[model samples]
Target chain A: MKKQRFDYGYILTLLISLVVALLIGAGILALTGHNPLVAYRALLGGAFSNARHIGDMLEYAMVLCLCGLACDIGSRVGIFNVGGEGQLLLGAIFAAQIGVWLKALSPWLAIPAAALGAMIVGGFYAWIPGVLKVKLKVNEVITTIMLNTVAVFLCQFLAKGPWKNTNKNIVAGTGNLPGSFWLKKLVPGSNLSTAIIAAAVITFLVWYILQKTSKGYEMRLTGDNPRFAKYAGMKTERIVLITMVISGMMCGLVGMFRVYGAEHIYKSTVSNEYYFEGLMVAMIAQYAPLPTIVISLIFAILKIGAMGMETAAGVPKQLYLIIQTIVIFCMAAETGIRAAIARNRERRAAKQDVKARKEGGNEHA
Target chain B: MHNNIWSTIFDPGTFSQMLRSATPVALAALGGLMTEHAGIMNIGMDGMILMGAFVAAVGSYFCASAAMGILAAMLFGILIGLFFALFTVKLKSDEFIIGCALNTFALGVTAFLSREIFGLSGTSGYAVPSLPNVTIPLIDRIPFVGKVLSGHSIFVYVTWLLVFLMWLFVYRTPMGLWIRASGESPETLRTVGKNPERMKWIASILCGVFCGLAGAHLSLGYLNGSFVEGMSASRGYIAFACVIFAAANPPRAYIAALMFGFFDALGLRLQSYVSSDLTGTIPYLITIIMMVYVVVSRQKRRERLAKQQLQRLEP
Candidate 1:
């Protein structure tokens, strides 16, 4: 019932968990015959060594931030949209197609059209599971996972079939979007683009909607207790459906960004589980919007830096994943750890109280 | 042409492949059923199976014995199950979040170890030990039935046995009742002087063991002694689907997995006529449809019962 604020205890727990995870990572590095310090140095250095690397990190962070926001919105409506991967793929392909079709148009008109197309496709894809969850009482998790596989296969089919690039060298992707549709790169030879500004604006809008709007209140209420929300005369089903669409649209926007800003084309490999990474970011942030952004940036650094660590210290990049998961595990167990610590303290206090009382009784006698 | 397509799709070899493909999923589904009945929604079985498959291959590679690989996988499975229980049961953490983290962890750990142990490709180039196909003496001589039923990996028969044994365990045993009660009503289970948490723990561990076996079967028996990165290929989730489709009934879960295998094999066979990519989506599409059908039929049944009750009240 209390507002979910990060009090001192929570911050302390998070810091302790992070330190414990790093220690575990170091132990793993030692076991694997890699120097932990060397690996850590490489990881940090790689993430920030040059302007290009920093730009790449920011580019990755933008996508991850959007994905995290998508997941966060779904969670706020008590809908777990694990199909963000699928939705993003569909969105990306649609955006690519739309981009090429509107190549004759001006950038202002074409870009927005492409973006809207992606959002429609993504939101529509998500709406299927939303409807099933709300109307049929079917589990959304299984359906979304199943749909993800279907979406991936569908994208592969489209990329290889009707949308296939005509160039012999381009093996399995659509033709590149026209130059007019491209988002201007902020750094030369880097993926970071003006799309980052749009992403930031969208993030701010999402934060406002979640924190300052009545619809957001309804969504949170529905997530916290659907039965209570229904009793209070809220349209819980509609809220869930709308939230699912919005979540999906965000995923779609990520796909459009990938096409218009970074890859400039639709490929089956446009995403390397970016949605899952974002989902992890959301989970680590405990489904909060602002924290999701921060975690996404941190995760992006780890992901990009892992490659450097691999090249420098001969440690596997997956070491970061292990560390991330360990941190998540620690966070998941925080409540238990706190409860155990409290119980120990209570027991010690009770023992001291009895001892002091006995001492006083002896003195009185 | 139609007859040829039918013949290709319905051949004895297809059924044999179906059984082979169903083995791992059936095994994992059986494991998933235990946790499902114990009131734990374990979406992490995929990770458990992935870990098991990797560990099994590694164990087989080093030990030169399939049995040892299976043993190693089972031991790892127990540890994973305990880890899962430590969070879900003991710590009262969100099971879904923990499950997701476990999946990610398993993916990372397996990938990391495989690259370290087997080199950059994350595959063992040399042949590791694999489970042998068992030929039943008399059954092997039978014409069509033997072709469909015999000379498969030993896990195929083991899975069939497990399906039957699990049915008996859940429906016929006292502990089985307690496990069900733990899911259905944990407070009632507590009132009967049994710890529901213990039942959940047992179920979780058993699920882990079964999933471990599923992984062993996948790498050692199904894939011919090779460890492929990400080879588990979401079968754990398919197994979860089977468990849901079967409503946690072991025999029914086996049937559900068989259906998946049948569609998978059909899709493979149809690849010559249809695009392989399109064919690949068939099983997943069918899974979604099946889930919808289950919900719809249940809803209809509930509506019919309500209508019947209303008529009786009017009379």
Candidate 2:
């Protein structure tokens, strides 16, 4: 019953937050001497203007979908994994290692090897912090973030030192994977790859795990009330560790797909925007599997469109980042609303008690 | 240019580098300590630092005064603090989420402003009038210690003083007692006719002030008065780790901050011989090790206590 009421509140909060955020975006554009309408139109047009643009946007959305699912796995189990960027990079490096080193293998063998490699490495790397959290009671958030820093540097090291491609003559990015390792592009001349199918499959799998399985129930219980779950004989520690590993594995898929489906080479300089975008997607979707795709698509449109706005309309791409932050702030503010409602109830109850005392006094008189 | 990475460990330059690098983190760590004791964690210190750096750079650049830059940074800190308190304290928002949002938002707005105003991601290397490095009288005559400590921006000295003050503030003062009570038991604070929420807001504001100063030091003092897109480089996160390392103790946190700074300096020094990228991971890796040690030791202590209780019961 409370969840139903909160559903309405969440929608109201989202709508209000979006409106305020848009207004702020417009104000910022104006302050920078750009026409907000033209810029927005350019942005929309750029994201969906051509078949190719739409495909690009879809590709980004697909990648974000997997990342969001990764986030959802941890969040639903009451863990905050801010190491999505690190995990993704670790996956990329693993995929790159297989794709580049094992270049002689057939397409069938090479592709699966790359995918499996990414998943295992990403999951295993994240499992360290999971063990720390479960056995030693170390806070996962700090550990994950620290690991992210390490992972980022590790990727950079590989690119610059051991994996340097003399052919590319660049120090920061690995060489492109063999064509056989690449995901077959869906739309010719677009980043849209077989990754979209992977996104769909993963979505279904996440839904199944979260809804149709006893494990899912246990995980949700752990998230909702860990003490209650423990009292009910659930091993909350094992659940947390498994959930983190699974979440990290899902993030690994994002890196693998990006390597095979999107960027052929891992660019260390690429902004970590997608990591946070995934987090935001999962948050806005309330950790549900399906809604994450929709949220991811919306973000992809803004991000891809912002490039167009930058070129044709003289607006910076940072505008999308600003909007993302606003949405996150609004969503986070929901907790504040929850607290306020409780306070109001307490005040009302106190008032009723006073009224009852007064009625009793009058009756005695 | 020694091939040995270990040799640089004893170099006086390395120590000075650590001192310079740790100054900002130590300040930010102390700030975070305030919020931690008040039962809040300002994970958004990175954002506050970025905003402070940008505003300080802008202030110093336009007004041509380092003093103005510091002042501007502090003012903006107060503003950000109020913004944080309003959302986290008054509205009771999820502090971590709000903090992450604030940091991201700060990154965006500052990047946008910098691009719009200066048409660059970082400053254009103009001569930015910064706080002058000072050479202490007798200290300058000493050897390695003098070289390490004598010459630095005034903010470096201020940080040491602030650390001492914070130690006193969190431990000796009545307000310090209240802050601890707020974190430990807000219900107790309420029973005593005080608002724990209000205390958190105050802590948040103080955090902002310290974070702001940290940023000013980075942009105006350390970076020679230049605002860079990511000059903070997760120092805020490092500061967060330092808070955990010291468990909210100001002096110990200061030491923790220096430890990271030392590793960071070591990474830079090792770059001539080893892969710099690999070396750069040292600070983060050490931080993780420190966290693991702290937890492991605590767990061991708990196990020992449990064993002692079991023995007593048996007897």
- Whole-model lDDT values for every prediction: 0.89, 0.84
Per-residue accuracy of model 1 over A26-82 as CA lDDT, tens digit each: 998889888889999999987899998899899999999999999999999899999
Q: How is the predicted docking of candidate 2 categorized under the CAPRI scheme?
A: medium
Q: What TM-score does structure 1 among the candidates reach?
A: 0.95
Q: What is the DockQ of candidate 1?
A: 0.70
Candidate 2 residues lying further than 4 Å off, grouped into runs, are A1-9, A269-271, A338-342, A354-365, B1-6, B125-127, B304-315
Best by DockQ: 2
Ten contiguous residues with the weakest lDDT in model 2 chain A:
A356-365
lDDT of 2 by residue, B1-315 (tens): 443556677788899999998999999998899888988867899899989998998998889999999999999998988889889888977787788788888888888888887775457656566899999999888988899998999988999999999999999998887887888898889789788888887888889989999999999889887888867888888898899889899999999999998999998887777788888899988988888888888789899999999999997
- TM-score for chain B of each model, two decimals: 0.97, 0.95
Q: Each predicted model: what fraction of the native A–B Cα contacts (within 8 Å) does it retain?
A: 0.83, 0.84
Residue-level lDDT of model 2, residues A1-365, one tens digit each, is 23224366666776787778888898888888988889889999989888888888898888788888888889888888888888888898778778888888898898888889989988988898888888888888888888988998899888877776656567677777887778888888878998889778888888788877899989999999999999999999899999999888888878888888878877763436578778877777777776687788888998889877888876778888899888877766766777788888877777787697865432110
Would candidate 1 be rated incorrect, acceptable, medium or high by CAPRI criteria? medium
Candidate 1: list runs displaced more than 4 Å.
Answer: A1-6, A339-365, B308-315
TM-score per prediction, in order, is: 0.95, 0.95
Instruction: Return the TM-score for candidate 2, rounded to 2 decimals.
Output: 0.95
